[model samples]
Every structure is written in C-alpha cells, then in structure tokens.
Target: MINILKGMKDRHSDDVKKYDFIMDTAKKIFSKYNFEKIITPILEETELFRRSVGDETDVVSKEMYDFIDKGGRSVTMRPEGTAGVVRAYLEAGFHKADPIVKWYYNGPMYRYEAPQKGRYREFHQVGTEVFGIRNPYLDAEIIKMGCDFLEELGIKDLTVELNSLGNVESRKRYINDLKDFMAQRFDKLSEDSKRRYEKNPLRALDSKDKGDQEQFKDAPKLYDYLDEESREYFEEMKKYLEIMGISYKENPKLVRGLDYYSDTVFEIKSDKLGAQSTVLAGGRYDRLLEIMGKVKIPGIGFAAGMERIAMLMDDSLIKEEKKGVYIIYFNETKEYFIKIADIMRQNNIKINFDYNPKSFNAQIKKANKINVEYVIILGEEEKDENIVTLKNFITGEQKKYSVDEVVNIIK
Candidate 1:
C-alpha cells in the first residue's frame, strides 16, 4: 500500500474536531475586535515571499514548496499567511476600502521541512492583520487579544518575549555592526552562521547552532543601536502593554524570522510544548505594503500555529460530543422511530436513530456508548399507545410521554 507523504499525517474525526474548535474560538474573539475574515489562494508567485519575507530567509531559500507551473511561471505554495494576505489586500483593492482595515484568516500553510511533534510540513495557522494603523497602543491591543484568546483556551503559564528591531535606518546600522562583530570570529562560527553573516546578519542572531549562539554571546545587541525615534516607540509600546496589565520580558536578541518586521516584535511562548514552545508570534511591519505594492501602508499582525495550540490544549476543554437524543427501536418499530426523529429534528432538537436492527439491550448499549443526553425506546406497547419511553441518561429516570410531550421536553 502507498503510504502518506513524510512530514504529513491524516487527521481523524477527533483531531479535526479539535482543530475546528480552535478556529471557531479564534473567529469569535476576532469578531469582537471587528476584524473581518479574509482568505487567499494557497498558490502564489514565488517572488511574493522572496520580496516580503526576505530572499535570503530560510522560508524562501529552503523551506518553500516552489516549482514551475505548466505555464512556465514560477509559483509557490504559501509557507506563511502574511505575505498572501498582503498580496490579496493590494490585488483586490482593499487599500481603497477603510482607513483602518482588520482581517483574520485561518488555513493551511506548506513548507518543506523536518516534521516533529506539533510541527508539520503542511500545518495550519490562524493569523490577524491590521492595516493603516501605527499607534503603539494598537500594537499592545493586538498582543492583549492574542493572550486573551490563549487564556480562553485554558493555556496558562505563557511568557511574552518582546523586542524592538527599530526603523529601517536603525536596523541597517545594527546589521552592519553585527556583521563586523561576527567577522572577527568568522572561523569560530558554524558553516550556516558564516553564510547567514554575509546574507542576513540579523538571522544569525536567531541561529540555533551552538557555536553560533556562543559567538552571539558577546555580539552587540540590537537595542543599543535603536535610533531615538525607535527607542521612544519601543518604550511607548511597553508603556501601553504595562497599562493594559500585560507582563512581558524584553529579549534583546528577539529578531523575528521575517524580513519586514520593524519596531515592536513579540512572541507568546508556553512551556507545555518542548523546544517548539512558541504558540503565537508577530511583529510590526510598517513598510511591507510599500515594498510589495509601492503603496505605503503600516500593518501589524500575529500568526499562531493551529497544530501547536491544539497540541497544548487540554482535551477536557473541548466539548467534543453534542448532547442529543438517541432513538433505539426494534425491527418492527423502525418506521415509527424514524418519524419521531424527524419531528424532533424539525423542532430544532438534535436527534440520532440507530439504523441497524438490534435487540433492546444491544441498542441501549449503543446509545450509552454515544453518551447521548436521552434515549428513546420504540417498543410495541409504546407504538400501540402512540407514546414513547424516554430515559434520561444522566438522571437515570424514565417516563412515558406523548409525541408532542417528548418533542417539548427534548426541545
């Protein structure tokens, strides 16, 4: 038999249900902030990510699932949500809509990488983006919303890591200085760090190599190079976060993976998922839209991996079963049970009926297995009297009720 692809796995009903619950919760939370839903195609031009996410970044250079299409045009499966959303915003003329546009999207994202627990090649993300806003308070509000959503999911013990990449000029100076520092120990650095040092020095700060990390120990911090404006912006963002009663730790080395991020960047981490602990992360990208469409638009947003969140969630937190009535009937009373089920369903009551002919005891066992709220028996006596035997599974009480009475009770 052919096996599933590496780095991918099939999700059964239970897993899918949990995934849906996460997305639904996110939708409700986002709706409270007046953020509308937006969806972009899975396939996009490869250049979109290269330009917005940085051509030198791993996502564009190594992880992207890119190939030439039949038209001889290069396209890539979206590895992240932000670039596609930005592309759609400009292509669909959303820039002409509102001065401040808020959007949330949930869908699959593809990347070519090694799969580990809670990390997959084809994973899902629920992300939010706001355009035309530059206030530091708005940044705090977004962070608060993300934390609130995680708290709602019963995920506590979260640590928020905050940083500032500063404006373009400030980042440029920091990168140059970082390069000079890394240059002194180029031989001591790992092969990957040496390559990153030349291409994208900021990424080297985020390197996972032990030798590179040791090299970064004495390297200059990005915060030291923040211009006056960037310093004030970072300080203002922290003040707002403090005013909102949100606690965060400043990480001087927290340069996010994306190239477009600037000023404030934050990540929400949980101790539950080992190694891959980050549940949600985002940063301010004021110049992304300008680079992508030549139209300047200030935007801030965060994306959370659905797989990671679901992995960390407590199973009891999700209401997996829909409480309803299950009908158990003998072969002779199948028609009667079907009619009763239809009536209950028409009245907006959730009802299920067993199609297989089984003994009374066997059908009752099936009803119990499903954990239905109530079980209805359609035996001969009840069918003749035009009444049904309704048993409350929770209360263990049985009563005889007319069709109308049963409908009322269930509804």
Candidate 2:
C-alpha cells in the first residue's frame, strides 16, 4: 500500500483546531490594519523566483521544487510568497491603479529540503505586504501589527531582532569586505558554508558552524560598513520602534536568507522552538518590483510560519470555543429528531446528531464519547409529543421542551 511521504503531515483533531485559530486571528488583525487578502497561484514560471528571489540563494539553488512541465516550459511550485505577489502586482498593473496598497495572504509553500520538527517540505505561511511607502514610521507600524498578530495567537516571550542591509551600494561594500575576511579562514569553513561562499558570501556569515563562528568573531560587522544614509535609516527605524514601545535589539549579523531585502530588516524570534526559533521574519525590499517588472516601488512585508506559530501557541491562553449541541435519537425513525435539529439550526444554533438509530443507552454512550455539551433524546413520549428531551451534561439536568422552546434555550 502507498503511504504518506516524509516531511508531510495530516492535520486533524487539535492540529486542525490550531490552524483554524491561526487564520481567524490573522484575518481579524490584518483587517484592522486595512490589509486586503490576495492569493496568487501555487505555481509560476521558474524564472520569476530566479529573478526576484535570486539565483544564488538557497531557496532557488537548492530548495525549490521546479521542473519542465508538459508544455516544455519550466514551471515551479512556489517556494515563497513575495515573488508571486510582486508578479501579480505587475501583471495586474496595480502600480498604476492604486497609489498605495496593503495586501495579506495565507497558503501552502513548497520546498525540497530535509524537515525537522515544525519545518516541512510542504509548509504554510500567513503574511502581509505593503506597497508605495518608505517611511520608517510605516515600518514600525508593520512591526506593531505583526506583534499584535502573534499576541492574538496566545504566543509570548518573543524577541524582536533588527538589522539593516542598506541599499545596493552599502550592501555591496559590506559583501566585498566580508568576502575578504572569510577568504582568510577558507580551510576552516564547513562544506556547505564553503559552497555558499563562492556565489553568495552573505550566507556564510549566517553559518552555524562553531569553527566558522569562531573565525567570524573578528570579522567586520555589516552595520559598521553602512554609509551615512544607511546609518540614519536604520537609526530612525529603531527610534520609531522605541517610541511605539516595541523593544528591539540590534543584531549586526542578522542578514536574512534573501537577496531582495534592503535597508531595515527584522525578525520576531521565540526561544521556545529551540535551534530554529524565528517564527516571523521580513525586511524592506525596495527594488523587488524594479528587479522583476522593472517598476520602481517601495514595499515591506513579513511572513510567519503557520506551523511554527501553531506549535508555539499556548492552548490554555486561547479559550476553547463553545461547541454545538448533539442529538441522540432513541426512536425507530429519526423524523422528530430531524425536525428538532432543523428548527434549532434555523435559529442559529449549531446542531449535531446520530445518523443511525440506536437504543436509548447506546445513544447516550455515543454522546458521552464526544465533546458536545447538550444532548437531546428522542424517546417514545418526546417523539410523539413533538418535543425534545434536552439534557445538560454539565449541570446534570434534563427537561422536556417544545421545538421553539429548545431553540430559545440553545440560542
């Protein structure tokens, strides 16, 4: 028999509950900030990612699930969200339509990589992107909304880490200097780090190797190489976060795993996830549109791992939602039970019932196995009288009520 593959999971029971909670909480918070939902196709031309996300980054070079389709066109399952959103923006001519736009999206993202813990080959993300603004205050507002999103999910103990890549000129100078420093300890670098250094040297700075890190101690900090303009941009963004009461720490080595990011970049991390602690991360990518569509626009956004957030959520903090009513039919025919259920449902009461007729004791046993709080019994007298025997499992009480009366009580 065929079986489920590795790095994939079937979400049910409490896992489904957690996903539902994450989406509902996300929509409410994103709506408050005037962000509209946008969904792009799961597959796009392979060149889209290679151009926007970069050809050298691990996402494109190693992780993407890409292939030549039937039409002999190279198509790829989306590895991330930003590239698709930017493509849709340009394809739809949104740059000419709206002066400023706020959009959010939630969907599964594909990658071909080893999975660990909450990380998966087929994972999901809920994220937002804002266009046509470059103000540092706007940057802080996005961070504030992100924090509120996490807090709404009952996640706590998050640390906000900030860094700046500056513009192309500033970022370039740092990369050149960093390459020079990394070249000295070429022999000490890990195999993977050594491979990354050839094309994308910035990724080597993010190495987890102890020996590589030891040699990195004296390496020049990216912040030290930022030009005066870049310095002011980073400082102003930090000041805004401070004024908004959003605490942050400067991580001079925090260059995210993306090439489009520029100027201010930040990550929201939680120690609860152990080694892979970052739950949400984003940065300013002013030239993304320009690179893909040759349109000059400023945009900033962040994507939070849905699985990671769900794993970190404290169930106690998010109160269990009130469940619907359950019906246990004891009559030969479920005619009365069906009628009562419809009436209760029409009145906005959630209703559940046994499809097969069962004995009085048997039906009650089934009801006890589930989480339904209120159970209705359709025995002889109640079925004949067109009434329901409503039993309050919590209070240990029972009463006979007409169809209308049951609706009123349940509602």
Candidate 3:
C-alpha cells in the first residue's frame, strides 16, 4: 500500500520550490502591468463550469471532479479560472467600483484525467483576467503580458498560435455551415467527435480524431465566416502584435474548448515539450461578463500553466534564495533555544533548524544537506564564552563572535 501511494506525488521538494518561484515571478510581472490579485474558492457550484466551459467540453463532461456537498448541492473543483473570476466579479460588485478590472490568480485546479507529463488530476495555473474592455489594444496588451512572462522564465522556441473565433454573427453562420458539412461525415467521425457534433460541432474541429483532422483540411475555415467588422478587429490585433515584434501563426482551427470566447483566441506552444504542448492559453471573452450577468462589458485575458512552464525549463534553475544562517545547536541547549531563535527572527535574518533533536554530528550533516550559505555552531565553548562560531559553508572559513557580534555579522 505504501509503495503504491509513494509512486503518486503531491509534488517533490524540488518541484515545489520551482512552483513557488514561478508563482512569485508571475505575480511580479502581473503587478508591473497593474494587474491586481484575486483568488476564488477551489470548489464552486457545478453548473458554473457546465455553463461557461461548455457542456460538450471534456472538462465539463468527463474530467471535472464533482460531487454533492453536505448540503446536497452539487459542487465541483474549478477546472479553469475565467468562470470563477466572472462569478466573483458579479458576486462582489467590482464592476461598479472599477470600470476596468484586471486580476491575477495562482492555484491548483482539479480535473479527473489520466496523469501524464504535464496533465494531472491536480495542477497549478497562473491566470490573469481583464474585464470591461473590448479594444483590440487590450487584447494585444494581454498577449504581450503572457509573452513577457515566458521571456522572464528563460523559455524560448515558443510560437504563439493565434485565432479569432469571430463574433456571434460569424459563429452562427459558421456553425450552420459546419453542421451541414459534418452531417455527411457523421459516420466517419470517431465516437467522441460524433458526440461532440451533437453538442458543439465547432469543437469537432479541435478533435484529435485522425478522420476529423483529414476532413478539416478541406473544410471551410472560420475566417471565411468572419463578418467585415470582426475581420477588421482581428487585422488590427495582428498589426499590434507585429509592431511589438510578437510572431504568431493564424491557426483558424484552434478553437478553444469553451463557449465564452468570442474573438482573438491564442495558445503559446514550445517545441521542447512534445505534441500536447501549450504553456499558455487564453483570449478575448467579449461576452463572459454579459453572460454571467455582471454587465455588458467585454474583455481579454490569458492563463499560463505553471507546471508546463516548469516542465520546459531546467528544474535546477528555480531554487529559493539561501538563508543567511543554518543553526546548529546541541540537544542539551533546549532551554535557550527559543531565545536564540527569537533573536535571529526579530533581526530579519532567515535561519533553518529542524526541531527534532539529533547528535551534533548528525545535525552538521543535516545542515550540509539543506545547503545554506552559513552555519552557526552553539557548542559548549561558544555558549561558555557567550559567543557563537560562524562557519561559511561555501568558503570553509570560520570565525567566533559575541552574541551582539553574531547579530551584526548576520544582519
């Protein structure tokens, strides 16, 4: 039993350290862009997702981790960020206060899918949402923010795949056309695509079915259905991306598996990760707030999967900063330990010491294991002289200092 459970990871220590670094870096970049942070509950009313992510999407149909709560209300862990952000916007009345709302959130989202290199039952995402704006410039700004984040993480060889899912009129016309085209291939589609055809025929374009992909090669692209207004809106967005030196491919078939997105959908892909590889995915959801009943506002945003970013980058690159000292004390000094700990902490110095008592030799080995830059030995000689022996682990240098001097040396 233990062996089987051990094989499943909550996350390794190194993986967690990298995850923290990614979150911190993402927050810093988002803050620079004047984006505020907002976190919604992990569990929410199940219908919220069923409505927003689309009932036909895999996240809503098969993958969501949903169950009845004690109150008998069906609730599910959030599979995506946009829906919950919209819910919070309506529930909190933020729209009345700020004409434009920009928020960032980082947390784990649950989905009951087979765990793979990047996909997991529980995974982390750093997402940003901007509400109450529909200008093409806002869409460009959000895309640039996502690009900036990946650049900060030293990830390269990434290509942004851009697609505009046309406005309501265009979508309505295309769906009708697509429905008619697929009627002929109803028998040719995989069982999954056939089911998707019944629920959302556009989603069949995103299907992995070999027969579906072949069918789409000659199929009518969504771009053909874009009304002049939607086409002009899309052209302006691409022009802005070019001005900012952001390269992208127009992938008409990249329809994000959601109902809220109206125009300017995009995904950032890296060649380092094999095929199912999207490090960041999001776009303009012009009707999300209106559909959620907040306001008739339109907005654009994007979310980056922290795990996929970590997977592409070197794992050794995201370690935490070393603390100023690693404390080493004899088990017998339990009486004075709290006093010394308090002093170090109050002086704004970081110190690491396990509470578990161990032999002096064992403690030294453990100190080396944590790999802190310096170690402080509180042995009999130093305690007798009211001094501490400080050793620089990196340089193998040692010095003795009084209590006040120890504080000075560290602080």
| Reference-based lDDT, each prediction | 0.88, 0.85, 0.82
TM-score-best of 2 and 3: 2
User: Following a full C-alpha superposition, what root-mean-square deviation does model 2 have from the true structure?
Assistant: 1.8
Write model 2 residue lDDT over 1-411, tens digit each, in one string: 988888888889888888888988989999999999999999999999999888887788899999999999999999999989988888888899784889999999999999997899999999999998989888888998999999888777779989888888878888888888878888888887788777888777778888888878888888887899888988888898899899988887788656678888889988876754888999899888888878889999999999999889877755676677888775564777777777777787877767776677877787777777898877778877877888998998999988787777777
Name model 2 segments beyond 4 Å from true. Answer: 257-259, 274-276
Residue range 300-387, candidate 1, lDDT tens digits: 9999999988888877877856778888888888778778878888888887766676787888888888889999888989888989
Say which candidate scores most in lDDT: 1
Off by over 4 Å in 1: 257-259, 274-276, 394-396
lDDT of 1: 0.88
* Model number with the top TM-score: 2
Count backbone clashes in candidate 2.
Answer: 0
- The whole-model C-alpha lDDT of candidate 3 against the native structure comes to 0.82
Cα RMSDs, all models: 2.0, 1.8, 2.7
Models ranked on lDDT:
1, 2, 3
Task: Count backbone overlaps in model 3.
Answer: 0
What lDDT tens digits, residue by residue, belong to model 3 across residues 217-286? 7778999999988899999999998998899899888996556679899998888856647789888888
